[model samples]
Target: MHGSTPIRASRTLKKSHANFYRAFHDYFVTHLPSSSLHPDSRSSSGPHHQLPRSASKPHTPGEGPSPAPLLGGTRDTTVVRIPLRSAKHHFGVSVSRGTRPYNEDTYQAGVIEVPAFAKPRPLNLTRAPANSPLEAYRAKQREEQEKDSGDGEGTSAESASGDPQVFYFGVFDGHGGSECSDYLRETLHETIEETARKYDLVSTLKGKPQTAAIVSSSSSKEAAKDTAGSATEPAKGSMPEPSISKASTLQNNLLNSWKTTVGGYFRRFKPTAFASPPETPTTSTVLTHAFLQEDLSFLLAQLRLSTHDTDPVRSDAPLNANDSLYSPTHFPSSDPQVKKSFKGGSTASIALLSTPTPTPFWHPSTPSTLYTAHCGDTRILLSRVSDGAAVPLTTNHHPSTPSESERLRRWAASFVTDSFGEERMSGLANTRAFGDMSSKRMGVSAEPEIRRIDLNPSEYAFMVLVSDGVTGSVGDQEIVDLVKESKTPEIGAREVVGFANEVSVEGDNATALVVRLGGWERRSEGGGGGMGTREAREWRKREAVDPRGRMT
Candidate 1:
């Protein structure tokens, strides 16, 4: 009788959920345009009754149709919401608890808009007199300016007035516990922005010339060379003594010209030190490493402060009435009593999609470039219609990797593989991660591998960021094919998580983030699978040997 009662309750809950879904769907369908509705809802003879040829047929796994052309040949394509069964495009996300008591996987996706007014303006330097000692210097200055401008064309007023949007997505997988992953989800982006701002300021300062000093030195050297070279061969009508005076005069003129130029450049550029710069530029991998290190240090300091008292009650005291003693901020990194509480660590994988500045003229509609930074085993995969396959954007970082295993051995850390056949470093599978203070002394690093890829809007389809929970159970190609078969990104994400849960025996938390790279378009026809397979393989091989290349 008790079992029957629970079964009846489950049926009732399912029915209620179904009713709610149906009501929401009906409300949503009513808001869409009449033409976007199902054919039965629109008259057969209506002007917009016919569906696009690509949408008419159902897409099979790994058989995505060619993408439809971008409306008006630009990224400003219209997004039409349709019924779930007919939906063809939408960004989606899925987070599943799987069989874990607590889910430690987290993902985020959103657009960041940067206004044109926020962009840096070029400096205007004073022109030097023709044939003056400073003429070569002026030529060099012009060359530098041109190179900085890229393509010698400044941003147009129209482009400057418009706001460019960038999409960012990331996946974080926590081990031991979810504290570190949750903390990163809240603060990593801001930290990256701060680091980028510092880098930009340093770059700007380094680029600026000590105009007067440089010009004076160069002018003096050139004048002395001329004086020495001309001494042996005096011109037919020129006075030899006057030539020396002329060289001195030329040096003086160059110095004066440089002073004026420097004044003008500074006045026009107004290069003031910014307290903060906008977060658009790709962040250096070192910044990621430094940020994690600093944050961990700060946490450790705070924890030390909170637990300095030797008294059991005082040392374990909570920060507030509602807060727990084991909260990330209060839990001491070194305290053995709370090791289980504070030992949690997490892996971070971030993908930043940013619009290039001085937007390329040839491809004015160029898609945003993708920059990725990862530590641990979470993966990023790019699906390209041109390739018709999934391409791995990041390699997993675990003890299984030769580099990681060698590093662990060098550190002399003791660990044993579990029943799952996974190698561990001081009981941690990931060789690099954030907040593994217990293993930090054992050589687990916070450094991340970074990579950059220019996305072509025409051929790019979508990108997936997933935790190992998904990759452990599903193949890269299978994930790509599943996404291709789904009508929209959201559905694709849900399907991926669902598949991972079904296949994974370990019951780890599963999370997937699917980001559409371009506007809704039908998949192209007759494209070969895996366009950059060879290049990707070569890149992985090279990176394994030297993971620190170009990181900073």
Candidate 2:
């Protein structure tokens, strides 16, 4: 009888697991908005074209139901699979078109390889040249590459070991159409890597205190004089250093140091210097430049095509119509005029995790750095396993913000309010986005706000990047909590998307990308799955109104 009890317990556990999944499947199919399930129900002409029935299977209400399979069971066919090259890094992505006829959300995740010759110059008190940092870095990289190829040596940094690797993840939310997002999905990361190689090629101030500041050659004399005059007192007219408390954590100390170093190296120097201090190239600057340049390029290509239709010379030119830039059929057109013009825009939230190679220049105990570049409302959140805290790394860029509103006002851009009372800049919700040629002239810029964080593996578990579809409906902490108890990152991403689909009234296209960091697989005590999720609460409320429809 004792042996039989053990067998019966194992069977019961399996049955319960199966039942839970069955219930989820039933709820998902039943609650799915009718517009998504029935193609004819949606308008034939609109920004969102109806997806083919073959794109996804729609389970009609009251029809025969079955347990959803693991991978193939999802309705949307737009799920992105990670490449085998990036498999070493644990990550997962889930993308689906909910109530919309087509999915405009897209994501990219993989490893980016920085050039082996890329290394930051050693820190020195002496002022550097006035040349652009990007130009100088490129010239040096070219010379170093030639020398390395001849001698078969790596980076010039003394005792340097291997090349640094960057784990790159990005999610793009498209409005107007998916063309812009699709183009960004294919090209944005490449542009970032190219820009990083030219501008942020080196790891600056590694293995040393970040107190040293790089100064301009012209301000060297005044800077030295000010430094000699004051240990505690400020010079006649100079920016004062921001105070740092001893009680602050190491992370906070590093952050303050970075701000002091980058904000103004000549903090104690006199006023009447040249114009302003030369900008120092860093990851943030690199990302900002990449976003702006990419946006400009996308807009230029779109505008050129839009005007080329009326240009007789362009029509008769020998250019290849199949070329990516010239091809009108490359992406679905959202324009009503059927012109070859590309009319779409997208919001981007990108996170790059940079880990130094095993080199003497970098300390063995040094933590990886996370650099996030954000434009528009897509979100990036970091989950700390130590205390189960959710930290948002990017701020949403909307016209409603004071700074954004003021900036738009300066450009003489008019604002419009949607039926939902949401303010928009020239008919677009986001004040910053990519490839909206029309809005570009109306103060809609692609300049991304950048944030830097020193990632402590033991303290941080994972990072999640989601499109506005998920963020619009789920709270940051709730999203992190939902993933906390998942068995794997892939399952967590699916659950987040599923929950967002259920909560959203318009059925927006949803996407979630989870990257497992050092603290992944480690969970804070007393944290796991339960019935306390937002979806569960909503379900309970619905059940209260219809007791007969309740699930056992």
Model number with the top TM-score? 2
Over 4 Å off in model 1, which ranges?
1-90, 111-163, 201-282, 289-302, 305-341, 357-365, 524-552
Candidate 1: residue pairs that collide: 65-523, 66-522, 66-523, 66-524, 67-521, 67-522, 67-523, 68-521, 68-522, 92-490
Q: 314-356 in candidate 1: lDDT tens per residue?
A: 6565555223233322322322223223567788888765543
Off by over 4 Å in 2: 1-89, 115-162, 205-276, 311-320, 323-340, 358-366, 526-552
lDDT of 1: 0.51
lDDT of each: 0.51, 0.57
Give the range of the ten consecutive residues with the poorest summed lDDT in model 1: 209-218
Instruction: Provide TM-scores for the models.
Output: 0.54, 0.59
lDDT of 2 by residue, 1-552 (tens): 775665566566656644432211101111123355445654775324343444335544332222112121234422112232233335667888998999999888654544222223333455447597856765565566446533222321221222443556789999988888887877777677666545433343232111123221113455333222212322223223322221123223323432343223112222211112312333444465567667756765676577778999788875554443354324323221223567778999887665443221122233566667788999999887656778897777788887677766766446788999999876788888887666665567676765556654356777899998998877887788777767677887888898787766677999998777667656444244322355664674476456476545
lDDT of 2: 0.57
